[model samples]
Target: MDELVRWLGVQLDADKARAAQWHDLECSIHEHQEGGLLKAVAALEVYGEVPGAVCDCGGPARVLREIDAGRQLLALHLPTPYQDEGDRWPGCTTCSWRDEMDDLQVRYPCKTVRLLALPYADRPGYREEWRP
Candidate 1:
């Protein structure tokens, strides 16, 4: 298999595991409903700034951008497969704790460059709640 595909598979597995944890703790849902992993991965964003802090891989950290779109924009489009499974994916951004989000974003450029899970207060539910 290609490196990027392999990397994505690993990332997906980790994300799915995280979703299971969240479901057990918060949602009380058991099955791996579609988009569960995506929702969990999207919720891992850090909002504030940190001075003199480098990524786990020793690279400069990328700060969060002002996202005008909804928090669950990515979730709106579920079941979207890898753009080109045959093509090699991009390398990880070299962050700690298996944060290949940047790499995934780069690989799927058409999705959205700005990734931030801002609080959608006015709404009555979480992004995953409205999965269609």
Candidate 2:
């Protein structure tokens, strides 16, 4: 249970960093500016210390930061993490970030979390949107 909680914490951090792009929320340990899209990490020392994670880009940094800021909450969404890295259990579907798909995040740590954003209008106003 403890292991599950810890990894989930990491996952949540990654997810929240990306979420900060469209929302005014602190997703990291310190305050940072949002980038062109979600999961977009800001410059070094520009906002605060960069997140030390598996990700090597600003995007993942953004997500991690968001988690630290408490903008998004994470729960054990799955029973396991591929291997036996953690314990598997029932009722692991209580994660809040599990069902919400915002159009700002392109991907997540170790996986791709698709969130598409299309231009709106004649000059940034509206046009058409098609999702399948």
**Structural similarity to truth (TM-score) of each candidate:** 0.20, 0.20
Model 2 is weakest, by summed lDDT over 10 consecutive residues, at: 111-120
Clashes of 1: 0
Candidate 1 least-lDDT 10 residues: 57-66
Off by over 4 Å in 1: 24-132
Report the alpha-carbon TM-score of model 2 versus the true structure.
0.20
lDDT of 2 by residue, 6-125 (tens): 444454544564465533223333333456444444444344444542223445455456455442333223323332224132222332133354222211221111111111112232
lDDT by candidate, in order shown: 0.29, 0.34
Q: Which stretches of candidate 2 lie over 4 Å from their true place?
A: 22-132
For model 1, which pairs clash?
Answer: none
